[model samples]
Target chain A: MRLSLGPLLYQWSRDAIEAFYAERMADPVDVVYLGETVCAKRRSLATDDWLALGRELAGAGKQVVISTLALVQAGSELATVRRLCRNGEFLVEANDMGAVRLLADAGLPFVGGASLNLYNVAALRLLRGRGMVRWVPPLELSRDDLGDLLGEARRAGIVLETELFAFGRVPLACSARCFTARHVGRPKDRCEIVCEDYPEGLPMASQEGEPLFTLNGVQTQSGAVQHLLGHGGALAELGVEILRLSPQPAHMGEIIGRYRAALDGACAETAVDRWVTAPLCDGFFRGAPGMAAAPDP
Target chain B: MKLVCPAGNLPMLKAAVGAGADAVYLGFRDDTNARHFAGLNFSDGSARRAVAHAHERGCEVYVAINTYPRPAGWRRWQRAVDTAADLGVDALILADLGVLDYAARRHPGVRLHLSVQGSATNSEALRFYADAFGVERAVLPRVLSMAQVERLCEDSPVELEVFGFGSLCVMVEGRCLLSAWTTGESPNTEGACSPARAVRWVESAGGTEVRLNDVLIDRFAPGENAGYPVVCKGRFTVNGATYHALEEPTSLNTLELLPALARAGVAAVKIEGRQRSVAYVDKVVRVWREALDTCRRSPEAYTPRSEWMATLASLSEGAQTTLGAYDRPWQ
Candidate 1:
C-alpha cells in the first residue's frame, strides 16, 4: 500500500521544519502534504518555502501536496488560499468548504482532508464531483464504516481513491475556542504562539491522572497515538489506496518503514508490537468502541 | 424578527406556539435529528398533530433531519425527510450534505434551514450550500463574534440566524467527539450530546460531582448548582491542576445584546434546548420576543429589564448566563 504523510499539525523551528522534509526526501513515503494545517500565525516556513520544498520532495520521487489551514477565518485567509491554489506545482487538500470552493472555482483538483467530515457515500459523491479526487475518511470511522463505504462504492459503479489514517495520534475534534491557547491564558488572537512549544501537543489528563486527550490549539487529539502497524493485513484487504502517517517529533521514518514492512507481510504481530508503544486499537475499524483495543472482546 | 424555537415534545411544541414562537422545530423519535434524547422527540402521530397544531395557530412547523446518517440506517432518515415533505412542514433544518442532497432531490420545494450543528463557520461554506442546494437560512455557530457575524452577512446570500440564548458549547458545533470519546453514541451521527444514560451524579465529601461514562466531568459544593457533565465543559487536569478549563456551567444570554446583534445583520434570533420545560421555553421566548420588539422600536434606546434577566437566570443551565462571545470581555 502507498504511504502518505499528512500535513504538519504543529509549529517547529524553520530549520528543523525544512530538515524534516529534507530528510524525508530519501524516505519511503509516497505522498507528502506540506503547509500550516493548524494555526495561521505559524510562519516558520513561508508559503514560498513550502512550494520550494514541494518541488524538492517531488524531485525526490515523493508526490507533494500543499494543504490549507483547517480554519480559514477572514479575507486574509481567503487570499492565502488563492495563493496556495495558484502555485499549480501540487494538489491542495481543502480542509474547509470555503477552501473547497476556492479550489473548485480556480479549476484545481483537490484531496478531501479529514476535517470536512465525509461520513457517507453521498457526501463523498458530492465532494468528488467538486474536484475531491481522493478522500481522507473522517477521523472516527471504524473498519465496519470502511466496509460499508467500500460496499457503497462497489454498488455505485465508481471507485474513489481512499486514504486511511493509519498512524499517529487521532485528531478528535477542532473548536473555535483554542484550548491550548486558553490553557496558556491568552486570547486566541494573541495566543503568543504557545502551541509552538508543545511539539506533540500538551497532554491533558483526568483528575485521576488517566491520559485522555491532547490539546493542540483548536484541535483535540487522542492521548494515545493511534497505531495501525498490527492491522496492515486487514487494511490491505479492505481496499485502502493509501495509509496516512502524521508527522511527530522523532522516529517518524521508522514508523513509516514499519507500516511498509507490515503491509508486505514480512513481520509478525510480535515484530510490529516492538514498533508500537501501546496495545492495538483498531476497534474503530471493526465497528466497536473507538477506545477499545484490538483482539476485540 | 422570526423566532425558531425547538420542541422535543408535543407539549413544548404547543407551548412554543402559545408563546408566540414563529416556528417550532422538532425531530423524529429516531436518530434522524439532533436532540435525539431517549423518550423525547415525537411519534409519527405526535409529529402530525404537532405540525397541525402549530399551523392552525399560524406558527410554522419545521422538522429537524440534521444529523449525518450512518450507512445502512438511512431509510428511517429518508422516511423522516419524506414524511416532513409530505406533511407540508414549513421547513426542514438540515446539517449533513447527504441529507441535503436527498431533500433537495426528493422535496425540492421544502424550505431548508441550516442547523447550527452543521457548523457553517463562515460565509463561503454557507454560500456553498446556497449554491449547491437552495438553503434559505443558516443557524450561525455560537463561536462567531458579532463583528464576524456582520462580515458573514456581507458575503453570503442566505439569511443569517444567530443564537439569542442557550447552552454555550465552547467547542466548535457539529465537529465534536466528546460524546464519541466518552459514550459510544455521538451528536454527529446520533444527534444526542451527553446522553443521560451515560451520566451519573454523585455526592462526595467535597461536593456533588457529575460523571459521564465513568469519567468525572464536574464537582459542586453543597448549596451550589452543578451543570450537566458534558465532556467539553468538564473539569480536567493539565499541568497538575484541575479546573473547569472549558466553560463554567453557564447558559448563553444574548438577550441583553439583541439590538447589537440585530444591527449586525442577523435576520433572526434562535434559542436552544428542545428538551426544556414549556414554562422555561415560554418565558425565554416571550422575554426575547419582547426584547426584539423593543429593539425594533428604537435600537439604541432599548433597555433590557432586570425581571427578564432574573427569569433568564432562573431558567438557565447553572443559574448563570453571559452574553456568550457577544462581548468578548465576558467570553
Candidate 2:
C-alpha cells in the first residue's frame, strides 16, 4: 500500500510546518495532505502558503490534497470550503459536509475525511456518488466493519480507494471548543496557539492519574500513538490502497522510515512484536476499546 | 412551534408540560441520552407513563436516544430505542447513524429528529443525513452565530431548532469525547458529560474547589458562587501555570436573544433545563415564553431589562453569561 501523510492536527509555526513538509517530501510518502484539520484560529500557515507548499510538494512528485477544518463553525469557514474545492492542482479532503457540498457542487473529485462518519456501505456509495474519489473510514471502525463496507462497495461496482490511519497519535474526535487551549486558560478566539506547545498535544490525566487523552486544541487524541507497522499485511488483505501516517513532531522521520521498512518487507516480525507495550495503541482497528493495545499479532 | 424541554424524570415531564413546554425530551435510565445521570430518567413504566402523560396534554414527547451508543452499552441503547418506538412517542431524537437507520427502518411512521449529538454543522452533513434517513428536524449545536445560522438555514431543508437557554455545551455535539476521556462516559455511547460520579466538591486552602474526575476545574472562596463540575469550565494547571482553561460553569442564559434567534430562521427555540427543579423550569420558561410571545407579536420593542438580566445572571454560575460561540468572532 502507498503511504499518505495526513494533515497535521495541531498548530505549529509556519516555518516548523514548512520545514517538516520540506523534509517529508523527499521521504517515502506518496500522497501528502497539508493544512490544519483541527482548529481554524491557528494562523501560522495561510491557505496561500499551504497552496504554495502543495505546489512545492507536487513538484517533488507527491500528490497533494488540502484539508478543511473538522468543525466548520461559520460562513467564513464555508468560504474556506469553497476555496479548497475551487482551488486547482490540489484534491480536497472533505472533513465536514460543507467541504463535501462545495466539492460536489463544483463536480470535483475529493477525499471523504474520517470526521464525516462514513460508516455503512450505503453511506460509502452515497459519498462516492458525491464526488468522493477515496474514503478514509472513521477512526473507531474495525476490520469487520470495514470488511462489510468494502464488500458492499465491491458488490455495488463502486471503484474507490481506502486509506487506513496506519500510524502516529490517533485523533479520537474533534470539537468546536478548544480543549487544549481552554485547558491553558484561553478562549478559542484568543487561543494563544497553545496547541503549538505540545506537538503531539497536551496530555490529559484520569482521576487516578493515568494518562488518558491528549488534548490537542479542539481535538482530543489517544494518549497512545497508534503503531500499525506490521499490520500492513492485514490492510493489504482488506484492500486498503493507502496507509495514513499522521504527523507528529519528534521521531517522525524515523517513524516514517520504520513504516517504510516494514512495507518493503525489510523488517523482522520481532521488530513489530514489541509494538504492544509502546505506550500507544491500535485497539480500535482490532475491534477492542480504543485505548486497549492488544497482544502483538 | 414545538417547545421541546428536558425531562430528567417523569415528574419533570409533568413539570415541563405545566411550564408551557409542548414536548418533553428524555431517555431511559440508561446510557441512551445526553443526560444519563444516576437517579434521572425513567424505567419502562415511567417511559410509558411519560408518553401517556404528554399525549394526554395534547403535547408531544420525544425520546432523546441521543448518545453515541457506546460498545458496552449498545444493547441497552438498542433496547431503549425499541421500547421508545413501542411506547408510541411522537418522535425520537437520535445521534448514532446505526440507530437512526434502525429506527427509520423498524418504525416507519415515528418521526426522527437528528439530535445535536450528530453534529451536522454544515449543509452537506445535514443533507447527507436527510437523503439517507429522511430526518425531519435537527437540533442545532450551540456553535453557530445568528448570521451563520441564517446562512445554514438556507440549505437546511429540515426544521432547525436552536438551544435558546440552558447549560451551554462548549463542544460540538457528537464531536465531543472529552467527557469520555475524563469519565469514560460520552454523549455518543454513555450519554453524559463530565458526569456527577466523576465530580467532587472539596474544601481546599485556596478555595472550595469543584473537581471533575480528579481535574480541579473551579475553585471559589467561601460563599462565592459554585458552578457545576465540568472539565472545560474548570481551573487547571498547564505549562507550569494555573488558569480557567476551558469555560467557567456559567449555564447558558440567552433570555435577551430570543427575537434575534427567531429571525435567524430558527424554527424552534429550546430551553435547556431538564435537570432543574420544577420551580426553576417554571420561572425560566414563563419568562422566556413572555419574551418569545412579545417578539412573535411585534418582532420589535424587545428590550433587555437590567432586572431580567440580573435575575438570570443570579441563577448563572459566577453570575456570568456569554453570547457563547454566537457572539464570539469565530475564525
Candidate 3:
C-alpha cells in the first residue's frame, strides 16, 4: 500500500504551506494533494502559486493532484475550479460536482474526492464512464460498507483505485457561513482573515466541557484524531491502494514515519494506538458509531 | 411560482391538497427516502391512493426517492422508482446519479426533479444532471443567497425550485456527516439524521439532557424550551462560553422574500416539513398559497401580512424564524 498526503484543510500562511511541502519533498509519501479545499478568500497561495508548486512537486518525483474547493457557490469560485482543472499537467481531485463536470467535459482523468458522495457501485460506474480513474471514499463509510460497494463494482467489471482517509481529523461538515467568523461576530464577506489564527482549527466543546468538534473556517471537523496506523493490513486486504494522511500543524512527519513503518511490515498491525496522544477513533472502520474508537485492533 | 408542500402520510397529503397546495411531495415508508422516520411515509397502496386523491383535486404528487443507495440496497430504491412510476406520480425527486439514470432509462416518461440532496449549488452541476439524466427541474440546496439564486436561474438549463420555508440545515445537504459520526447512520446513507431510535432523553439536576446513541448532544434548562436533538442545533462551548456554536434551533421563513423570489422567476417554492403534523401542513400551506396568490396578482402592493407571519412563527422550530441565506448578512 502507498501513502498519499491529502490536501490541507486548515488555513496556513503562504510561507508556512510552502515550507511544509518543501520539507515533505524528502518524506516517504508517494502522492501529495495540493491546493486549498476550504474557504476561497484564503489567498495564501494564488492560482499561479499552486500551479508553480504542483510543477515543483512533480519535479521532486512526487505524484501531485490539484484539489478543488469543497463548496462552490460564487461564479468566481467556479472559475477558479475551471482554471485548476484546465491546468492540464497534474491530476485533479474533483471535490464538487462542478469540478467533476468540468473535468469530465474536458475528458481529463480525475479522482473523485470523498465529498462527491459516490455511495453505490452505480454511481461509481457513472463516474468511471466520465473518466474517473480513482476515488476516495467518504469518511463516514465503514469497512463493510466499502467492501460491499467495491464488491458490486467488481461484479460490474469496473476497477477503481481506492484511497482511504487514514489519519488526522475527519471533516464532518462545510457550510456557506464561516463558523470561525461567526464565532468572532464578523460576517463572512468582511471577516479579516481570522482563520489564520488557528493553525489547526478552533476547538469546540460540549456544554459539559467535553471536546466535540473543531471549527475550521466554513468546515467543522472531528475533535478526535483518526489514527489508523494499525489498520494497514486490513486496508490492503480490502484492496485499498493508497492511505491518505491529512496534514496537521505539528508531528506530521512523525505520523507519516509511523504509517510508513506500519505499511512496510516493521510495526505490528494493532500497535498504532500508542503513536498518538489525542483520543483516537476508528469507529467508521468497524461499522459502529464513527466517534467510537475501536478497542486496540 | 408553484407551491410544493410536504406530506408524510395519506392524511397529511389530503390536508396539503385541501390547503391549496399546487403540489404535494412525499416518500415511501422505507429508507428509500430522506425523511425515513418511524411511523411516517406511505405504503405502496397508500401512495397510489394519495396520488389519486391529489389528482382529483387538480394537485400534483411528486415522490421523493432522495437517499443514497448502498450497493446491497440498490434494488430497494429501484423498486421504489418503478413503483412510483407505476402509480403515475407527477415527478420523482431524486439525488443519486445511478437512480436517476435508472429512472430515466427504465421509466422514460417520468419527469425527474433533482433533490436538494444532490447538492447542485452551481449551474455546471445542474447542467450535468440535465444533460445526463434529462432532469426537468432541480431543487437548490439551502446554501445559496438570493443574489446567487437569481444568477443561477438566469444561467440554469432547467427550471429551479427553492426552499420556501422549513427547518434550516446549516451545512450543505448530502455532504454533512456529523450525524453519522455520532449515530452510525446518516441522511445520505441511512435517510435519517440523529435517528429517533438512537435518541435518549433524561431528566437531570440541571435540566433535560438529550443524548444520541448515548452521546450528550445538549442539556436544556428547565424553562428553556427543548428542541429536537439535531447535532447542529445543540448548544456547545467554544473557547469558554456556551452557545449555539453551529446553529440555533430555528426555522427558515421566506414569506417576506416572496416578492424577491417571484422577481427571480423561480419555477416552484418548496415548504419542507414531511415530518410535521397534518395540522401544521394544513395551516402553513394555506398561508403560503394565499400569500403567493396575492403576490402574483399584485406584485407592486405585495407585502407579507403580520397575521401570516404570526401563524408561521407559532409553527416554527424554537418559535423563531429567519430569512436564512436569503438575507445576505446572515452568512
Model 3 docking tier (incorrect/acceptable/medium/high): high
**Which model scores highest in DockQ?**
3
Clash counts per candidate, in order, are 4, 14, 0
Taking the tens digit of each residue's C-alpha lDDT, what string does model 3 give over B289-331?
A: 9999999999889999999999999999999998877777888
Candidate 1 residue A180 C-alpha distance from true site, Å: 1.8
TM-score for candidate 1, residues paired by index: 0.96
When candidate 3 is compared with the true two-chain complex, its DockQ is: 0.81
The per-residue C-alpha lDDT of model 3 at residue A138 equals 78
Residues forming the 10-long window of minimal summed lDDT in candidate 1 chain B: B322-331
C-alpha root-mean-square deviation, each candidate? 2.0, 4.8, 1.2
Task: For residue B49, give model 1's deviation from the true position in Å.
Answer: 1.3
Candidate 3 global lDDT: 0.91
Instruction: Provide TM-scores for the models.
Output: 0.96, 0.81, 0.98
Rank ordering of all candidates by DockQ, starting from the highest:
3, 1, 2
Ranking by TM-score: 3, 1, 2
Instruction: Flag the better candidate by lDDT, 1 or 3.
Output: 3
Model 3, residue pairs in steric clash:
none
